[model samples]
Target chain A: MNSSLVFLIVFGVVILAVILIYNGIISRANAAQRAWANVITQERQKNKIIPHLQTITDQYQQFESGVQEKIAALRSALGGLSSEKMDTAKLAEVESATRNLVQGMHIAVENYPELKANELFGKLMREIAEQQENIGAAIRIFNQNVEAFNNGIEMFPHSLVNSLLNKKSTLHTFNDSEAEAGFDYKPNF
Target chain B: MDKASPSSENKQLATFLQSLRTQIYHAKTREDLRHVLHTVRSFGRPLCYNNTSYWLGFSMGILLGLLAILYAYWYPSSVSAPWLIGAGGLTSVIFAVLIYMRRSKVSDLSDALFKQDVYLDNNWQSVPYHGKKLAAQLSRQFSEFKRGNHSREIEWLVKGTYQGTDHQFDYHAYHFHYVDQRQVTSTIRDSKGNVRVTTRTVYDHFHRYGLYLPFRFARNIAITNSWFGGFFSSSYKPASVEFNRKFKVSASDELSAAKFLKPAVVVEIEDLGKALSGLNLEFNAASELCISFEQNICQWQRQHGLDEPDAFLQEIEGDQKLATLQKTLERIHTLMRHSDNNF
Candidate 1:
């Protein structure tokens, strides 16, 4: 075999490998954006369930749903949706309401063995706990995907096409403040 | 948002300005600021309110000038000319000067009060409409509205803020005198029974006054009061019987506009217009809601052929001015009340 032929084949194979690597990175970046959106959806669902759980807790008369302004915050957050268009203000409202409500539920049910023992109530609480756990899992998955996507955009070979894939929404959703330290900071009421 | 108070003599507004484009004067506790506007208007009788006297003065000047021209051209040379043309010239100058003097007083007074009552900077006292940035933003939102910046004289631009229990929003009262050149085509007939067509460019000055506000929405929308307005905009019908009757709201999509103009906000807007007499509000929406009405808020002495206007008056009752001001403030508050809430 000619030495030049071998070199050409090796060069062609290397180029093919680079093209596949670029495509893989692009796919990963897009997948990360979707995962981030899903995490936010989970947050919204958690917000939706919070009030119902608090109402149930209130019926038991065993714990206070530590929400200082439950009705107003919840009303503003829920009513503020204009057909899936939520401004940052509305998102903040929903986040604050949900955070407060969840915190209150946990506080009120701490020592209430009877309330916790109620089979149906126990199931509801467990469901809420599971959802809370899923929120963490979702956040972890989002952060992991974001880490991979960040590499795609920052790495030399893939950086060339990264601008095309850089969505403005990605920057907003992957706010370092929100995703850092195990998602410790939720919106404060 | 209580950044400045009316009484705090040194309420320098450089910091309160959003840019050179928008100036805001936040009254400390939100007292009735309309009294200030009323007191300013009533400071002196409206420059040309007495139509008969004004026209008579102007007509007399014209008569004098016409008489002088007649004396110069049509006077029989057989008789000694009394130089009546000079007299006519004097009359025109006197009439002009008199109008100039009164207008100057009125203009000056308005300036002084506009600065104080409206809580504006001294720099804004004579500002011509130079909201190029705002105009650009507006043009992007409403493709029909152009910023012919070549001949724009902005008289007053005030954005007032009212801090509510929860959030804060803004209402802008901005007015400008703009010049637009229009090509006019006309037909001419010659003595030889030949017809000719001619076109000439004419400059027209239009005063645009609007109470503009920004309302947050899910997306862009355009709403107007007239079909001509729809000529430049995609017509939007929310299909709510009351909304269609009261306003012509448009958007790129029907559903977005319909969803944005919630019945409750529409009611508030209607009530606001009713409260402010002579304010016929037209609606448009983008990232924010724009409640606009065409009513000149700027008072220019030169535009009125006056020298200076007054803001303080001694004899005339300010009741009418006060009433109008009250209504204006009420309307501003009503339309702008929820803007801070970002709904």
Candidate 2:
């Protein structure tokens, strides 16, 4: 009976440890998903300001169809934004496109000196900058979560728990080749 | 030239430094410590009376400088214009020379600091130090310095090991230049004008200093700072009303940063951040922590006669440099103790 009791106690400790480790992995994975969601939220925030920006652009901008095309592309990308939905390559394309569109809009505005000094345009730009910053911050957060989750799954002891969960690594990275190839932006008068 | 035997002075210096190292950390053996301190000096500067001469010279220089300024102001018409300017320039030059000469003398406290660092370095070498450029890794991932010019300088370095990892902490000053680089095309193209499109890269630099801890991760991890975060900053919003809102951590995933920023890591990082006095720990930069100090690390100051052999011994009780070093080491230890948990 004493031997059986010892075996039971040992079994109980092992079970408790397994529960703790499994819980830790699930918690981290959930966090990664949440951060990815936040990235989407921030990107959408930036996207919402684009129409406001376009209203101003339509009033002042002349012969800057390049900007409109870029804006349309960015708007299209934002339409499909969702939590943990875009793979690494798609994410890279979206990020690059977003930056280019924002910059192109600013360049197009430069062609119109009056718009450059317009108070409404200035306010919209500030709002857009804030939104873009929020998106940048969210991406960093998302990347951090993905990395930590992967680490948790990859590191020993934790790796054992991760294997039990049957989870694989999901990298959040900038696709340099794709980003460079897709990005062909130039400002001309 | 002498291989087997050393001068008695060198031997004594080595022995003293070795003893000091053993007494403090006991991380190295006597034989090993001795070997490590070979030809190292106990005092980088000889202790001496910080006499009234330095003060007298400084005062004389200041008085002369003032007199020149006063003459230029009050007696512009009293003398010939050239002579007036000449007298003023002469005094100013003398004072400038004196100031230059006075600045380079190593202080008593600096000597002590050097000796202390030497011993610490010996122990660190045994523990095996680490040094790395952490931001270099992020440069590839982001376009932070792509369109413009950027430079990074390691201003100061401190190193130690914790949680079975070697880490070298650095105080870095970074300068970034944003320029409008555009291709300019000229209509006047000649045989010599093969370079039709000229690219202009005009750069102006803005610098900021931060404490950088670069360490290799056993596995992949990413952590970022939240929009409303930071322990002691003006733009602070206590999201959820918690006093422990020093940092808002976000992992690559939902709960990754929350789990990684464990109570142990948070408490330790908080203590370290607070002890840093002013630097705000930058959590969003990368997984490797970077605390933006916004100023230079404590530069070795002019000793203020604190290390003078002839100064009042009682006044020497507060060795400011040594105290600063002690505080810095303690904070660094606290920071590294829980660093491995994050990534």
Candidate 3:
């Protein structure tokens, strides 16, 4: 109840609040980055399957010229990709090229029943579908983390703490279209 | 294979059960009863205890102890404590005496009769299928089915082939039961600060319908409702917001899990969860597809005590039981198709 005692108690409470909020903000920011890293990992996995797709398609004469061009475009778009930064436009470009190549193969497989039934072709298509699944999951996780981070830095008491100490900005989540495109898998067989 | 039509299998089973009930009622001696019991055992492995007499005795003792506690409240507090203790000892003697009177009466034949009914109803055959082997295999392959101070058994297992439009697979369907035991210790302190520690054993019993299909999946995925979600742990999350909210999905491989849990599969599983509580599906790397649900969709009824010789047999509505089971199987078949249709 004394003046100095009251002052000390108030100071201690304020310091604890600040420390808690600061830790929360830092944790959310780190989680968002980790989720983005996972997305990058899945994207790299997709890239690794491109050569296998080309090889099998070529063997069956299913590789169209347009498909080859899209594969090249995909490589170029993803070549300068870095986990240190996120570029949505470049990611969109890589996704579009990948879709075109997959769709091209789908058309070719539809025209040839034997090629569609080939064991290796079936395995490669499964692999592509698997990569697409992982990519969708990763993107959704990243968006969830981004939403959490934004909520942490923009909410009431946390916002006051963030502005005064951490000075973090709100993050934008991935568009719904990006996640939806990954799930539109159509197998010819 | 029977020359009779599948539609008449139920009526034939019902007639067989009626004759079996008569034989049970007419059996005069323990030897006669044992002969009838052998006839029942030819059907399937019964999930019942032959040493049920011991359980009856133990239960009688507990009942007497509970009555003694009630008597203490009714009588005066000044009543001697040794008298009450002597009564408790007397109850144990009575329990032992009752257990010794078991002479394989018609009443003692309910357990075997129930098993016979289940096997006949499902057209399931009794074979030398080891329950412990399957439990150990499941524990070894899947983290969710890991053995943790639990005893498991699979009984009345039926093996058959299911021919789907796109694939044909062999399936093993059975009754799966496991009892989880935990030791709970509590400390009690009196006004004088004297502490008493007591340890009690607690048991949780789970009865489930389990099916195992030898199908290889791209990845191992575990689907369970929110209630049992904490029991499983995984780094991967489903993309659908509705699924993520309704169920807990996890897998060892992210890609395989996501691919296995397509949007259609997610919706089907979620709807199944709403229909059947405590439903769990696990697809493992060992090419085993295991599905278990806690609901008794088969509607099996067991006679617990000495009623009429035909009490349990009369309750065996095979047609109704098979109809419900078929509906559930169709739903599960739909789920399997949805998972495959992801590609």
Q: What is each candidate's DockQ, to 2 decimals?
A: 0.01, 0.01, 0.06
Off by over 4 Å in 3: A1-13, A56-62, A111-114, A176-189, B1-343
Give lDDT tens digits, candidate 2, residues B45-128: 333323344456556655665666676687776655456456555665665565454343324233443434443532323222
Candidate 1 residue lDDT tens string, A37-126: 544565555555555656665777545434435635665675564324324345455556656665665665676656666655565555
Better of 1 and 3 by DockQ: 3
Q: What is the lDDT of residue B66 in candidate 1?
A: 77
Every model's TM-score on chain B: 0.50, 0.41, 0.56
Candidate 3 residue-wise lDDT at B200: 97
Off by over 4 Å in 1: A1-189, B1-111, B118-138, B141-144, B147-155, B177-184, B202-205, B227-236, B252-255, B269-286, B297-343
* lDDT of candidate 1 over B244-301, digit per residue (tens): 4555665666665545443334555445545432333333444444444455433322
- Provide the fnat value for model 1, as a fraction from 0 to 1: 0.00
TM values, all candidates: 0.39, 0.39, 0.50
Give the winner by TM-score: 2 or 3. Answer: 3
